[model samples]
Target: MANTKSAKKAVRQIARRTAINRQRRSKMRTFIRKVEEAISTGDQSAAKSALAAAEPILMRAAQKGIVHKNNASRKVSRLSSRVAALGKQA
Candidate 1:
């Protein structure tokens, strides 16, 4: 239990921040999933567009400390490669 007033305020702030972070994480996942879905369908142009939309969201998540910067970069790189391969295959 947070007995001190400051402690209670801190708890409230934590709850608010947690909610915001959770929303951001969920949104980021949604964007990533869109790219994955596009890739799985084997539509090169759609995958490229989806990756374009997702890239900024992923970068923003990293910038905001929701995800590690290198992790985000790796994801972007991997997805870009997969999308590029689709073009090569077609």
Candidate 2:
């Protein structure tokens, strides 16, 4: 569909970028899932540690433009709060 050489190159670049971004996004979700699983099991320490690990991945995805910055911050905040509440539940 891209008749121009530049357009063809642009399509290739977009495909590459899309693949990279999709990988990053999937990785971020995996990290988030780890945190959630820890939370659901009510293991405060594990939840805390998982959240610790997930925070950076989420932020990095946002930094790389895979997700919105505020979205990342909000997820971190919510997870932090949930982990904090685990302390009181014990």
Candidate 3:
């Protein structure tokens, strides 16, 4: 239990921050899923476009501390490579 006033304020702040971070994470996942769906359907253009839309969101999430920067960059790299491969296939 937070006994002191300061401690109670910190707990409230943490709760608010947690909700915000959770929402951000969920949004990031949604964008990533869009890219994956496009890739799975073998639609190179759609996949590329989805990746374009998702890239900023992913990077922003990293910048906002929702995810580590390398983790976000790695995801972008892998997704972009898959999208590129899709182009080669067609």
Candidate 4:
């Protein structure tokens, strides 16, 4: 479909970027899932540690444009609260 040389190169670049972005998105989700799993188990220490690890990954994804800034902040806020509540329960 790309008749021009420049267009073909652009397509290749897009494909490469798409692969990289997909990897980043998958990794970010994995980190989030870890936090959720820890929360679900109601392990305060584990949940707190998982949240600490996930927070930076989420923020990095937002910084790299994988997710929105507010979206990352909202997730961090909610997870932090849940982790805190686990503490209160004990």
List CA RMSD, all candidates.
Answer: 0.5, 0.5, 0.4, 0.7
lDDT of 2 by residue, 1-90 (tens): 999999999999999999999999999999999999999999999999999999999999999999899999999999999999999989
Q: Cα RMSD (Å) between model 3 and the true structure?
A: 0.4
The residue-by-residue lDDT of candidate 3 on 1-90, one tens digit each, is: 999999999999999999999999999999999999999999998999999999999999999999999999999999999999998988
Q: Model 3 misses residue 86 by how many Å?
A: 0.3
Clashes of each: 0, 0, 0, 0
Model 2 residue pairs with clashes = none
Residue 23 error, candidate 2, Å: 0.2
Which numbered prediction scores highest in lDDT against the true structure?
A: 3
Residue 8 lDDT in candidate 1: 100
Descending-lDDT candidate ranking: 3, 2, 1, 4
Residue-level lDDT of model 4, residues 1-90, one tens digit each, is 999999999999999999989999999999999999999999999999999999999999999999999999999999999999998998
Which pairs clash in model 3? none
| lDDT (0 to 1) per candidate | 0.96, 0.97, 0.99, 0.95
Q: Name the lDDT of candidate 3.
A: 0.99
Candidate 4 residue 51 Cα shift, in angstroms, is 0.7
TM-score of 4: 0.96
User: Which of 1 and 3 is the better model by lDDT?
Assistant: 3
Q: Which is the better candidate, 1 or 3, if ranked by TM-score?
A: 3
**Per-residue C-alpha lDDT of model 1 across residues 1-90, encoded as one tens digit per residue:** 999999999999999999999999999999999999999999998999999999999999999999999999999999999999998988
